[model samples]
Target: MTAPEPGTDGQSVRPRMAQHYSVAPEPDAPEGYVAPGMPGAPVAGYDPAPDPAEPSAGRRRRRRRRRTGLAVAVSATAMLVGALAYGAALSRVQSSIGWLAIALAAAVAWPLGRIGGQNRTLPPLGALLSATGLLLGQLLGQTLRLHRLEGTPYGELLGDALRIWRADRHPVDLAFYGIALIGGFLLTRRTASTD
Candidate 1:
């Protein structure tokens, strides 16, 4: 420690000791030297400065959109798989297995609804998706049946399938389709509630 020096006014002044003590660093401090509690100072191996290589806002938004697009694509693929299974099952059996379509719609809608609920902004896309799946499954089953019975060509099955379904459509089938649409919409929608 240095001795106090006499001042011109008869008072003693303490020697400057900031360099030897734990204090805020000067603006011109050497690289890698940081004083405690200073902004941008590293603490516990953490750095506060933003990295130059970090993505910009637009890049981040694009990345998020890509991820969301990928998720929707995967969901659509799953819906197609479910529709194929429903059609195959119905074609092989003599009894009506239409109820399975309803179940599949609900199952697909549930996840979409849950995901939409979390966002609080996107409307549950599940209803439209599930309805499309139901229609596709029914069309597929009708096509398979027509091919088996009337020897419809593989290439023309889709058009013939649509024609047969239109000719043989029943009130009960419409009711089932309406029920599935309503159910899918309900499953995907989330209502806000007060605590």
Candidate 2:
């Protein structure tokens, strides 16, 4: 049979066929461009970029923030309630208790944030509401006190209470507002990126 096909050592060579069961590569792509994550070995100087959509095993997922409207509403409500509570307390105590109001406003911010389901925005809103509430509460207390005076006419106390802010001698009133503002600021401090 044509000299029986010369063998490697001058003997007859075997006639077995070659076999390949692995996945076939695309005919169009060049031989060197191997896809990532494949069993094929990685080629040098061609590291594939990590996919943005891929879920990394090493990193934590980021949490999205809550809406703003709910935050503001909750903060305002907390501030108002805190101020009213402080004012009512102040009226009974009947003294320059600005510090107490400041403390109350500051304390209310955390709960306000919690109510809004957000770490951001609510604290400042709460502080603002608290300060305003405190101021209003002070005016209310003043008006109530003036209502008890001997010759004060009805509805005149409002004007008198408004005028109190202008009085030069009433340092305590100014201090109340100032402390309220400062205290609000101090309470709403953001320690981390979350808030």
Best by lDDT: 1
Tens digits of per-residue lDDT for model 2, 49-139: 8789974544432322333455456556666677667656655775667777766666555555443444555556665766787777777
Q: Compute each candidate's TM-score over C-alphas.
A: 0.57, 0.52
Tens-digit lDDT track of model 1 for 34-87 = 688878666797656766799767886676556445545655776788889878
Model 1 pairs whose backbones collide: none
Model 1 gets an lDDT of 0.67
Give the alpha-carbon lDDT of every model: 0.67, 0.61
Model 2, position 12: C-alpha lDDT score? 57
**In terms of TM-score, which candidate is strongest?**
1
Off by over 4 Å in 2: 1-67, 117-123, 150-156, 190-195
Query: All predictions: root-mean-square deviation over Cα?
Result: 11.5, 12.9
Model 1 is weakest, by summed lDDT over 10 consecutive residues, at: 114-123
| lDDT of candidate model 2 versus the reference | 0.61
